[model samples]
Target: MKPSGTASAHSDTFARDHLPPAGQWPELVFDLPELLYPDRLNCGYELLDRTAERFGDDRPAFRSPDGGVWSYGELRDRVDRIAHVLTDDLGVVPGNRVLLRGPTTPWLAACWLAVMKAGAVAVTVLAQQRPTELATICLLARVGHALCDIRSVEDLLKAQVPGLRVTAFGGGAPDDLTQLAAARPGPYRAVDTAADDVALIAFTSGTTGRPKGCMHVHRDVLAIADTFAHHVLRPGPDDVFTGSPPLGFTFGLGGLVIFPLRAGASSLLLEQAGPKQLLPALAAHRVSVLFTAPTAYRLMLDELDGHDLSALRRCVSAGENLPAATWQSWHERTGLRIINGIGATELLHIFISAADEAIRPGTTGTPVPGWQARVVDSDGEELPDGEPGLLAVRGPVGCRYLADERQSQYVRHGWNITGDTYVREPDGYFRYVARADDMIISSGYNIAGPEVEEALLRHPDVVEAAVVGRADELRGQIVAAYVVLREGAEQSADSLCAHVKSELAPHKCPRAIEFLPSLPRTATGKLQRFLLRTSPDPHGRVALE
Candidate 1:
């Protein structure tokens, strides 16, 4: 049950061995080379066709929470029918953007596939988003047609965006996707999309302001499947993939859609993915590969004693840093090491992750194959090993943010500066420091909020924590901790503050603590530190804080 020996064993080879002495790391393994496309088509339609042909009707291609299963042949046929509906019935054509809003159900998946098959761009919106946000994304993407779930129609109607044609899935006939699938053609030719043709437009959380649409080409999906899947997950036709990420998020899209389809594997889509729902679903579906965030893993470990997780062979964690404690605890309980990676919405998917056998606790292993990364100073000069600096990367797939000057600021000299501070070791592993904007400058020392939060999580009483800089008259800014304690654990504010002081360095401990019932999170389950920074409880309004 030890950290290194718990999962599938492999060699201890480190990425440092492959690093170049001068400029960048070369010969990194990527995922795109392993795909099987009919002809040279780069669209997702080709990927689905290849999967159907390879797997046929052998097993389920997709499964739902209620045990509804669709074989590859059945799924492909439905996708074709939906494609016809998109083109002939709805007047959708190639080059148009179709806004797709729904949960992670089979219909959503089918609609997404059908959109790409019809040669239109698919713009995915998170199901949990409010009507305002949904409308904002729809307008930004200039969507004229929509394929949505029955539940989300109310919200869409409330948004009242004009010139939008709506079609519901799961309900019967006319507008319902089920009836359209039954009546439409079973076989449709795949669109011959170019590699550079835009396939999807994913919007980021836009913590600074309005969400920015990230345009990804057909090649990007194939590139991610080839880079991450071939090198990291290494999934096969028999692997049963399951995850908690929503289909709207790139993490979910890559793990649940691209990875499984490219590998000819089956995936389970859960409309709700809390620990309660996920644990039982894992057992019922016999999911072999699990993809989720660190917080969910910690929650699962707390409640997974009797669950049959023996079927789980791989667990991938992203969205946030994975604590060494959570990684070790899960491995001990489930005998699976959670593969940790650092991916950005702009980058499409994971560009740095550890292979199963090469995982090092507390590190975002190495640059993904075909990608090169370096820690550099503000001037873009590469820093020596172990020096904390801005993490810059150059890879096959890069960011093209929607009409934002910030994109240029982030992408400099062909290397995309992730705005994250990191420390590169002699062994080629990168240690996350802090987001450039999130670093707390207190008394001339740079304090990383996430690092302090990670330390706080090691304490048994603390269930969740968010650390940010608070305004201070003397120090300009001081570390403040917003903590959520475990159930049945009671501690005074003073005592809890003292507990953190005892566990961490005096300077690193929070200057003040605010006990909260729960931490604020984005729809994707990422902690929202921006909200915490603006709170008066931390400190009176101050620029640095």
Candidate 2:
């Protein structure tokens, strides 16, 4: 296997050669040979097949927070048993959608694997999601049955969506469907599924509006593993993978489940992976590779003064842009570069990422292998290097929003138009500018809010910063900043605003600054800028000229 550095070099080379000229649409280069399967197969079965053949009885495949470890052989056995139970006992079969609700645990992993292995579509809902969100997702997915943690059954019951058979795992089940691993037959055969058959339905964060389910086939899992893990992480069998992302998010799905299994590595699944829980888990597991978002890294840095993080070799930052200060601080403390990537629910996982050796702090780096990226104008015309425009991508796995006509809007003319603004350097590195929706149009000048946020993050007193566009009577919309200062840092609004104006363009600086104890974020750690857009001091009135 190539070293991480070598893989990044190959990716840089491909990006250099394939990226379109300034103002031209990007042309992708497909180098992979044709395959027997036109679409991808569900990865749960593929994982079972690999483990059963190679290290079935050897290493532990999953380690749960409760100190339970399941060997590959045991995991496969349990998955088979559950598959049989789902098919024979519950009457679930191919084309049926099964709702899975639970925390990130070994049982959740087993349930996810079993559902797909049984040829049923798995719809995973975040355990923290309220009853209304859960009910909407269940109704939208047309879920016939649900496998959820016993602790969360009350929430499901409150949703009051009738006719849905509920199966309780982790705790004793008193419901219609229960854990049948002990009683079900172990010799279960997987149903033959087409490559295009839907294996899982992941819901997008409703940052813009209501959440929509993003449909993905079995092939997307392996495709993401091959593109991101093979080309970016390059994990070995001995590598211990762990992170803070919830299992419900595709980011966690790729990092904790699919990537580790694809590379024959072991993963540490913590029931609670907040900053308070992550440090001890990483130390206890001797985790070598870490995957999390940029915000988590910032928080971890604060808690790592005397922590022994010597075991970590690579740390991946995703879900949002990685600030240069966060990257620099992490490297200075741990001597490890944080590999930043840009992924979406629509893409299923990461498409643009940087490996350790080739990491360009503050930039999202080049595209992963088998994927193509470009910065394009409003009309889909390619933008010149150093020019910010909307980002578009094409790869083996693309967005197929479930039952939504907006799929056409996201996927236009064979290119998935990811609603992100970015600038590509002449050397092929792509820097994240901001979300397309978060762009501030002030007096006809286009400004990416994230650029200003990054500038604020460089200030020593700043712990966290969020930038958003605020409505302005004169400028149409102006930049606004919400900041969380470090402990003992003064919260003088004027000084902070002055600091930002000095570092960034006067027009790009926050027209107002709001002090906060903490900024709100999604479970995946993405900054919730929409909340800031509606704030009372939307335009930073305190510092207005």
Candidate 3:
């Protein structure tokens, strides 16, 4: 499909100008009728105001643990007020980038919607980001204005982004955004933005080097909901959604905000949603649809003894590969089949997944409705079934990095090359092997780190494990395991290595083992294998000499 030829609604054309060259763009397939959107579409209005109009205004939209519930009408009103403040008070122009830094809350969500409603692009960064990271994002996105939570303002201010205007919120000061928004006590009209206009720029998590900004359009936002949520998740209006991801991540934005609102469902937004807090919150809020990582599901299993999970209906897992053992263990306990998916920051949300009876325990399901995916070799040619290769996807949405050279590397031959190795079964299910960079080559033998990690997790005493390749003199690379054992378990390194040897091939067994209290994980609960691979600590290290 060609780029939209309609006139743009943005006054500042930086985002549109910085988009990848038209020739380099991936082939976008909009086979589904719902994927076709009108030229003038403001996602904020479509998700919030339109939803409130369809569902009764009094229907709940957002909920807090403190019993605070914002009806769809109230949320629409708040978003309009904030939008007014952005345009009238802050002097923000259409297409200008606005930084949003804060924990997951209704107010933070409102700021995001307000930015879109005002026709400015949102650059939502995680609240846990430090000053250096904040500076990098601001510089890359060319952000000028920010709406930060009062508590998280220190780092953003410390970053000293040049010529940046900062607005504080959640503080009761006169200059706080809440006070300014209250002064404009009326409805505000949303910007008439082109469907292809950039609505947000999501920066990569920087797992390796510097982050790349992924630019997504307003239509891309609605497409995720219409395709994935409509066809796969199949959520109902009465369902209450909740998750552990911060809104900064696309996974969280889709699961908590876009999906629920598009479905006319309510969501419980939590600022602190670890496994410990998730157990009680699930029951207390009567959460029906749960979105989190595989590790959290494993941890929640240990605490499920007293929790009433009858209200929990749908569970979705992404971010990292979901081991089959985790899936079976979770299903054995809760009677719910976790929807496993694979998505990337380049793509706005999940493009491949399965739910309910269609789920294959070990596979990452199939291409989502309206999307097409397959495994391809280094030359971008499709690989035969059962051969591990690069995973490529193309649909209504694909990677569009803003003014970045990496855009060519991510999209080639009209396919978004996700940096993960996968195998397509003859039955059409895609099984994950490992990240292309995370594969360990020991004595010329290809070993997927996730397979080793999955083997370790199956041990009764093992609570968590992360496998990586350590440089060795004799062997090209040795498989090393970092494990966290169950409390009070006295499993020695020799015993754990023997267990792994029994489960996997002798060559795949971990030559070195290091026990730790917990695995290093990102704020979103993704295991940080890069840290394990780079750690210089040698104390207490055990090896199969």
Candidate 4:
């Protein structure tokens, strides 16, 4: 057997070549032998093939909003056909990075499994991204092939990077995976991949630069399901899952796809799921499980008077802090205690969470059964309970940023330092403090100010732009941007905000945009972010230069 440090000379070897050095990686722990996976593991085989084998094909696997559903047997057959299409038609082999762009749909889910099953890395990009954003991802991941929904063809075409071969699916385009899969005959054999083989490269917006790629392996996929979903969530086969988060977002990926499928259950896919649509869909599909951010829950609170969500057995909230008031308000409206937890794209899914019986309001519950978490000081020493410090976690899964130096900063002495400040209580619960960096956490979404600035700069009118988090009473923080327009530019705040929204995700849009003739800068012309942030509040500006 090859050691962990050696690379395999396989067709899909981009991820292996970009992994962090073995010594710099966060120390991985598999203290629990029962949950330990074999050295060679294929998550696609374990999550889908094994589930179908044991459940006897009776349970529903996935259902779409348009009244379409597939049983385990049907899903298995379809997945194999798609896997054959990826290999035989697209020439995809083990370890290749495949970019997927589209809304959350059954076909998208199938493509994800198909790519993994064929021993390739799945890179899911949001359909809302503009061509420029899409292009950046293509370059960063060195994506060999792409699969996009027909609706996204225009953007996909515009984001063309050399060497990226894109195939369109859904809406029956000539190059669709659906058509290809239909023509293929398959009960294709799954690829034999090691447990540490990279299966996904989830991107998180960068605070100081372009978006960063977080690599996760085959075992990391099962570890999330085995530890958190198994011990905390405990969803049964009869459970039906539904949510609003995009499949590109790890929070949504775990909530909507991995968790349910791991439990031998099903998920309801929706294109758009604001409160108005989510409530009725819940009643229509008899959704038993719900996953969304605190923002959505807050919006749905006022409309709860008439919604029939009695069928919902569990509601999981993440992507932001679950305030006690929000928790109390939710419990007051519906008799369900919201399952709140914290997870990052880097870690793949939730590692700290508490379910109904064990949940404590206002606190993110203790570490999951298979993980260890603690508060640490600047020197990386553990802090006593009740002292706010950096949150460091070590478990079956840890951060593996693709070839980024930030990996060193994130992982210190074998522990993953999630850049959040927290205080562990004497009773073993963890209380949220604030983000350890300059990141803006708004409406349960992480918004990097520099990324917003980069998006703002994409507009022709903007010459200089600086973004920062403004304190907010409800959403925690809002993106507040200061911009300097180019000569003869007359862009309104709303129009400029819209331009940013078009370039980036909706959550990253600037809520308060102020037009300034000039911005504070260092002697070397670097942005003086501290001055913009040192104001008395979101409304106050620092002493002008």
Best-matching candidate per lDDT: 3
Clashing pairs in 2: 40-219, 41-218, 42-218, 512-540
Give stretches of model 4 more than 4 Å off. 1-9, 205-209, 438-545
Predicted structure 4: lDDT: 0.82
lDDT of 4 at 401: 88
Residue lDDT tens for model 2, 37-133: 3433556778766755775567788987667788788888888888888888888867688888888888888888998788788898888788898
Full-model lDDT for every candidate: 0.78, 0.78, 0.92, 0.82
RMSD of 1: 8.8
Write model 4 residue lDDT over 1-545, tens digit each, in one string. Answer: 11264234246578988988888888777777647677778888888899988876878999988899988888888899999998898899898999988888888888898887888999998887788988888888988799889897789888878888988888776667888899999687788888888999998733334678999988888889888898899999889999988888887888888989889999999887877889999999999999987657866775787778989999998876676666887898898999999888889878888987789987889999899999999899999999878999989888888889889999997899998888899999998765676578898997766567766765767766788888879789878888888768885776786787687888888877777887774211235566777655434232211
Better model by lDDT: candidate 3 vs candidate 4: 3
Better of 1 and 4 by TM-score: 1
Stretches off by above 4 angstroms in model 1 are 1-40, 539-545
- Model 3, 403-494: lDDT tens digits are 99988999999999999999999999999999999999999999999999999999999999988999988998998888899999995888
Error of 3 at 481 (Å): 0.9
Candidate 1, residues 45-154, lDDT tens digits: the string is: 65688777776765688988888889888888888999988877877767677888888987798888988777778888888888898888877777788888988888
Candidate 2 ranges with C-alpha deviation above 4 Å = 1-30, 33-40, 173-179, 538-540
